[model samples]
Target chain A: MTLGLLVEEAGLFSTVQDLGRQGFQSLGVPPSGALDPVALRLANLVVGNPPGCAGLEMCRLGATLRVTVPSLRVALAGAPPTGDLPVLRSLTLREGEVLRIGRVAGGAAYLAVEGGFDLKPVLGSLSTYARALIGGFEGRRLEPGDVLPLLRHTASSRRERALPHPLPAERDRPLRVVLGPQADHFTEEAFDALLGEGFTVTAEADRIGLRLSGPRLAHAGPPEIASDGNATGAVQVPGSGQPIVLLPDRHTVGGYPKIATVITADLARLGQSLPGTVLRFEAVAPEQARIALRRQEAEIAALAARLHET
Target chain B: MCAQPAAPPALLHDPPRLLLLGDAALTVEFAAAWSPEAAARVRRLAARVAVLAAAEEGIREYVPTLRSVTIHVDPSRLSLRRLQAMLRDLPEGAEATAGEATEWCLPVRYGGEQGPDLPEIASTLGMAEDEVAELHTAGHYEAAAVGGYPGFAYLTGVDGRLALPRRASPRLSVPEGSVAVANGFTGVYPATAPGGWHLLGRTPVPLFAPDRPGRPALVMPGDTVRFRAISPEEFEGLWSAFRDGRADPVTACRAP
Candidate 1:
């Protein structure tokens, strides 16, 4: 079948999400989307769903979803369930049987189907802001006993296919970043210290931003600058001398000086990492990062194509 | 596309400086600090950009922060280059809306246990506690911005005479509805959040609510608010009425 099943038990933090609400940043709203884009695309492809269709984003400890109707294609991708578990895991759920995701292998997972999940749009977005309590399912985290209705789909074609295979979980990949436009705001010593040293993800991390614990990266210039726009991977060195890496739900702007920003290609991996994940940053040229991003996109597209063929 | 475009660069520097944020986002910033003029200008620009992005569906989401805007896009369909191009042709700025804007009359119970820092703030600003309370409630303040924790309305027009710095070390948690001021801005913490601001009093009003209609924020940008000091009995009665949903915020503030 096309549309999979409704979620009977939504794990840690689960909600329907797409690429997030974009143009509204000017409204003081952060664009919330799937944490792992690569996995999200793959899941959509595996289920024969449109690549842009909204999918379920599951955070640490996935939920137990029960497949209703008949059989359906589904794929799960995110950080490997702890211990280098494969990113993509395949499991079947009977009409009444519950599929449970134990503890989080990674912080997030993507549940995709042959047909996209049907959800009403809020401000033209299916993504949830939990804080604003808008978008997604009533704009809040999926709780136990929440009955979600699925977007109906057609029967599957006459074809047999092997379940999706998991990708190698790079739980320990070095975070690749590009020097920020404000890199000059930090001292050469602080900049060097940032790249040369390592940081551990603190427990105080969330979709808003990742707080890191390591050598404080002090601002070499004025501690305060006019508030400027920043993105998810912006490495903002706040007044505490500690760097806070902004994330999807980060504020629209900040006054802290940023030393560098993690290249966009690596943000998903960073977002999926659990607390205490040791991270190191390796600078990449902007051109190189762009090329790498294109390649990554192509790979995701290919993976989706493979699933459709089956 | 690699070469920088030649133009006057509008009000900002050359090419309207853009920084690649991560794999999926980019930030177009104006300057370093938060100036009211810059904040206003940025807000206007952000509103226009948001409208354009929504109309085109080329971008995902864009949020307006204090001084800049963050646009979240689907890298697959819209690349940084394309977004940059879209930014170049953006409609410039947001037109200031007319109408005096709705004014909110917030009722608060001042002094004693409710406001621990009231005396300290009064001393710091060299004004009597009653005088401080009088000055605070006398004028209407324009909401300058709404950031730094959800529902935290940063208001303008604090009695400049009562301005004081925030505590060196903030308390772990100030109860929700605590009215506080620091660094030339006065606000009521919508929720229980750690803050170094000077406490003035407590308002039982819900500043931030998720279930309410119309964006879920009590006081949004561009609203004017005036504080009214009330008795503890009034505070308790209003708190009960609000919690029970029997009273509307507008009605509560309007009542004597």
Candidate 2:
């Protein structure tokens, strides 16, 4: 019999996601992937899987699973959900065992299994863009009673693996931003508002964008631009004067002006920041942003190297 | 709050601006406004970057709009300044390539249930329904850029006379294949989506399919499209043919 995870509860908005689909942005397909790459990568490393392998991303809430696999290695990370299972450490679940995770502490939870699930990749990824019904398992959220087959069926037990150092999943820190692809569109005072008073994350948060409510950034001329290409974490302010930080599932092009792009190093913080959470921004030079990103990449790499089976 | 700079008159006279987008990408802005000339410039630069991406492992992917090209690169693998220099050094006089362009002829049924906004669109333009349809079909449209949705191309070259602003309030769900117009651009809804455009007609053809062989996008950048009015009967026949896999829009496309 094939091994699988029988979903007892599908949770709020759980979906399988990988690193992202690349090379299709020109075709209007935004790269939909894990919102917090740091946690997902660490979880994968702990499970002795490739750092970017496809895995289950439990958002807002977490799922209850019945393990049908003879032997399965699993790791939990991202959002530090209320669960008895250890986070950032890999452990085995035998056949007939049940795994349950409760409502998440941050905004989301991530669970990585050894080989992910057996599913056909759409456009070279398992990442779900549910709006377009593309990729992931049937390109939609997991429903109750869904059975996701394991990619690898293990016959024997494997040793546990864990990371030596805790990978930071910061939530309260100010998100670092690199200003402009359109910064000049806003008044200089807008910068002060963005970095000074900051914004509060609204309930309208999703994989597509984080809608924030704060002081209006007055436009120099008009709110709209000749719709241009989008980058992940682009903070776009439309005519209403509210800012929406475009995320992983954002449109490939947007009509509003983007004042800043949150740096790569701060995506984890952004991802974990829940609704009503007060968020702040700090402008960094592009060079500085790159250096901060490099440091994070190096740290993650070092941790991945140290990820060993016990 | 976010405000990107306005359309400065100086930007028109100044050289192209290479702006950093976060740490992973850089965008080369050729113009602040959308124009055919700017679109041509964008096409040329995108083609050049495609060649560059082949040689530089750092260049991950690129999305070319009508006025700019945003190239995503790996920070560890490529320096933003070096990439900017490479872009600046490349000659900007390259002709916009139309040699490989395919012009697709689409059949549409105007002013019906699928196009619920047709009456309002015609009345807003102060033209009869047929006159509005005629005006729309009289122009040759080019796919300026593909965004908003996969295979959904922003078809430029709408008849200036037929140009109308978007609806005061967008519909929560615009039907798939609905032909829409707004702010001088025309687009077909690849799937049912929230939209503000004025819908005037409907097409029976599929707009996007991820597993599609060859090019996944039915309409691509620089590709041209022309529409012809069809009876409701024809629309049904085509819809049935599409459902039966007998109609292929790819086969309908020809050399411009």
Candidate 3:
């Protein structure tokens, strides 16, 4: 049985994403995936789908999807809905039903279906990289008339469930980071300025990166480095001295000096921060960062196990 | 009668430095300056690491740049310290054998609407437009790095006389297949997007094809590339054939 949804009003910007395309960065391809992996996983879990299944990632302004089949199972995760619509819970929509997701409280939101989207994977991934105009639904944002095909779900997969707790939202907190391979490029004052509070996310922020504006970081040497491989969450300080936090859709390599990299555990929080949000940074040791990531993974595993038991 | 001249003491002027990029990635840098010696070391190390990664279970991916290699790993499966130790212990001076390099000849249409900046670039370099194209096509370049955009390659080997800084103001959108140069490196725009490099020509060959399985990029790091000038009519013919699967943009050359 085939399931589908027709786009009625595609909000700000929404696209289908998975865990990102891997093993391709060596060829200059960016891993364009959901900004918040935890949210995407949670949404999929609630809908009885695998954690890495493709789902819809909507930006601040939400979208409206019309169910075309007799019934469909879906769940929302990440941002809280502004209206009274239930989120972080699995719900079934009948044929001819309309599901409206209002403006999100955070930077983005994820909507997952029980059987996931039935789109062919491009380059081994269903994630969309709009910059290169490849992957996803037509390799671009969702349009009003686009019809997204959904894989048919088994009867056992269509049960209703709600998250034990509300999914965490992007909060006003210090984003923890690890001083980087080029930390020595910046002066002591610059380091202090970066760690201190005051940087505000600029409007230019997108899936590619979040540009921060504040004190200009002073460079001990030239700000340019030989072009090198870049990682997600790398806080790159270019010649202008402003810092740009690389994201999932960031270029495979860059030439600017990266003073620090935001720890993996905090990337979701960073992903949820909207434009104009004031943020600060705290440096941690590489060992500590590893421990934090392990802890996060353990927590997610425990959550999944508990849900299964329930 | 001759003992291979003591294999000219392996170029050790620049030692590789290993640095932690983050908790999950490590970068092995060979040298700050771009040179044949540095490029060789990078390729050698990358090859060694690829073998090591195949034997190990933790390495997720490895990307080789101009003079360095970045290795990504799963922090949960492997410790950063352990990976670093393994990299440090890799036997050095494993030169990349000559048999590994592949040569490709890319057909380009120089000047006209396809390359609007050709005249400006030629005038700036104090050379005629045809001379600029000839100089560009004459050199043999190595794909030092890939990334800036998907399938975008950074090729080294442009003559020093033709080297020029990037345009002060970048173009909002450069058409795909446009051959451009900047800061001693020549590259082709894999897709239409904003770029700061000076355009000298256009190629009918598609640099990137996500639809292709296995190797999506036509040009990969470490491959050798040469440009052959073609007329606009020839470009159209080749491009149509490529699109229709009647021709290949690249043809294999005899092993050098």
User: TM-score, each model?
Assistant: 0.78, 0.94, 0.93
Q: Is candidate 2 or candidate 3 better by lDDT?
A: 2
Prediction 3 TM-score vs. true? 0.93
> Relative to the true interface, what fraction of contacts does candidate 3 keep?
0.65
lDDT for each residue of candidate 2 in A111-151, tens digit (9 for 90 to 100) = 99888889888988889999889998889999988888888
| Order of quality (DockQ) | 3, 2, 1
- Candidate 3's clash total is 0
Per-residue lDDT tens digits for candidate 3, residues A1-310, read: 3358899989898999998998888999988899988899989988888899999999898889999877788889988779877777788888789999979888889999878888999998999998777788989999998888877633243358877764344376688888987887899999999988579999999999999999999889999988888999899999899999999999888899899988878888888878999989999988898888888888777776656322
lDDT of 3 at B131: 94
| Per-residue lDDT of model 2, residues B58-148, tens digit only | 9999998878889998877887888988776767553334348788888888887867877876787787889988988888999988988
lDDT of model 1 at residue A84? 41
Order by TM-score, highest first: 2, 3, 1
* DockQ winner: 3
Q: Per-residue alpha-carbon lDDT of model 3 for B120-215, expressed as tens digits?
A: 978887899999999999999989889889999899999997688899999999999999998899989988989999999999888888986555
Task: Sort candidate 1 into its docking category.
Answer: acceptable
